[model samples]
Target: MGITHRGTTRRVRAALSAAVVICAVTAAVPAAATAAANATDAVRGPTVAVGGLDVGVERISVATDEGYGAASITPDGRSVVFRSLKDVAGSGGNEVYVHDRSAGRTRTEPIVEGWTPAISGDGRQVAATTPAQGMSTQRIRQHSLDLGILPFGCGRCNEPSLSADGRHLAFGVVDYISHNRRVLVADRDGGYQTIAYLGSGAPARPSISGDGRHVAYQDRAYQKEGVYLWDRTTGTTSGPLEGPDTYASLVQLSDDGGKVVYLSGSDTYVHDVASGTTQRVPDVKGVAIDPTGRHLLYAPHGTGGPSLVLRDLRTGTDKTVSDQPATAEVDSVSADGRDVVFQSAADGIVPGDTNGKPDVFVRRLF
Candidate 1:
């Protein structure tokens, strides 16, 4: 399951300007640690050699804590934003971090005790779950494209997912009296919230499009249990496109929200929203799709072991991206289908990964 709710008593530093916070945090990190984090020799060349296999992979997270997850990458693959509990000097708790591949630097965001961060395609805006001021309720916070920190007033909202342009934010909010959790899409600048799903049971986390027009979610209600797509243009909800079995989960929509990739039982399938056709992708576990919805990143099963695979939907071709057969799982994929990020417990993915904990790694498909 995704990060549903995270309430913290840590301080919220929303008053500080983004420039001052960034400069202060960047200067606080020790030079030696910064150098060690950016020493990504395994990710520069065409192919990274791992146990005699060629795979261009680099482990990005160097945190000592083992709770790193919910990663998002820019469309250009230049920056990666994720939530980390790494202990920074004089900092309180977990915070959001952005790792720039070109600049070879990682810096913390201004949010305090943030969780489940999602970045926009341009790598400018970021949204995450943070504590409400003076309250234990978890609220959504956004570092908008204009460099201003914005907060949503929903006292019980979490698991924020953003559109590629960062203009729309999708998340789950719970009603206080009815105790029902529904998916909501809100405008970043318009101060409007639209309910995407309002049925009985709890809906799955929503996946939005670049223009915030389409939202894909799964309904857990017994009568209408399947994946669904909500279109804001028509102001209507499409369907619970029947899965193979009763259990269906892990729904992910492309940047255009025209296609959806999800898991049913042990198999993976991609559903075209317009045609209402579902195709079961054999020998792979589909996780995410690129902006165009043509390239899919999955983990092929029935092979030797689990490894990252990038499959082109149009050509029916597959490229194995992970070099070693460790405990790796695909997370997010870049827009151009060239960069992929994942997490694994195995070592040797990069040099100096001696923390003995699961770490996030990026693979370039070039």
Candidate 2:
């Protein structure tokens, strides 16, 4: 494994530009103390360790002209699903692929011919947007990427997300009519369940928790766009993540769906579903929550350039994973927060990483 050091300092100032709002409690979460007015403006920079944290770096895909990106590592850390462009001459498209670590470097296997691929925690099931076969024009269709897929209205679906157990899948649907957009979740064997319907606003991305009982999604059906949690047992949707005039974009949820991390304007917050308190995470971009809900992996934004960051929710300690300061766009992370996968064009993170092209790299924190 290669280890490098970044010499940049972390900086965060109070007074963010986004509108601030009080946290709202809903459903099971009890109301905690509210943040004082302008308190959201009083954010502090993340604490950084000297010399950065040493991490093991490994290249998962072999270099190719067809391109391999948008990768997702299983929670158990044994398998990864990624997007691969086809190298067929005169073709200008891509598909989703699965790479089994046990298979060595035998090249990734194409699981489905689609875009935006997501896999179940065990890596046994995959979901994606495949081109509808036999359609008059090129259209997108949702599928298990294997067999037993059903049809939906308007003939379109994308941004598919799977549950930890691989039993449930949540995705967005775009209908041909107005305000008819919807967010739906379906079981691999069961039919589709309409969780939230948007009559006025467009449908946002939908995600299911590890247990497949709760779903977090953006709802435009409300007067204002808000992040909402749909309860499966009651078949009702409630508990919109409250935020400033700046609508909160829920990015990640804890394994049990008891916590949520979202971005309000440029500021990010972590909301505890059990306590209903929102904790502001200063200067963190593209935030993600670990399955334990005790750790967070994020991209730190600053003039020092983008660095892979890990923040301990319990201890408040921040560790830098990449010593080399380069522009890194975070792609996806594992459930434990130990496996962080990101795209970077920098040369210092690992030696011989001279691929020059935007390549995908995984940093194993453990």
Compared with the true structure, what per-residue lDDT tens digits does model 2 show for residues 1-366? 000011111121212122211111121211231111011111111332435743477665555333556676767666666665544333334555555554443223333444557767666555666555443212333333223233433356666777876666677766655636677776655356767666654647676788888777776665546677766765556556646663767676666677777777667787776676778887667556666677777777675744767778889887666655433321266666777665556655555655565555667776
Taking all chains together, each candidate's TM-score versus the true structure is: 0.77, 0.74
Indicate which candidate wins on TM-score.
1
The C-alpha stretches of model 1 lying farther than 4 A from their native spots are 1-55, 62-67, 85-93, 112-115, 132-136, 144-148, 197-203, 301-303, 323-331
lDDT of candidate 1 over 105-159, digit per residue (tens): 6656666545557777667666777766544366776753334466456677777
Ten-residue region with minimum lDDT total, candidate 1: 1-10
Model 1 deviation from native, Cα RMSD in Å: 8.9
Clashes of each: 1, 2
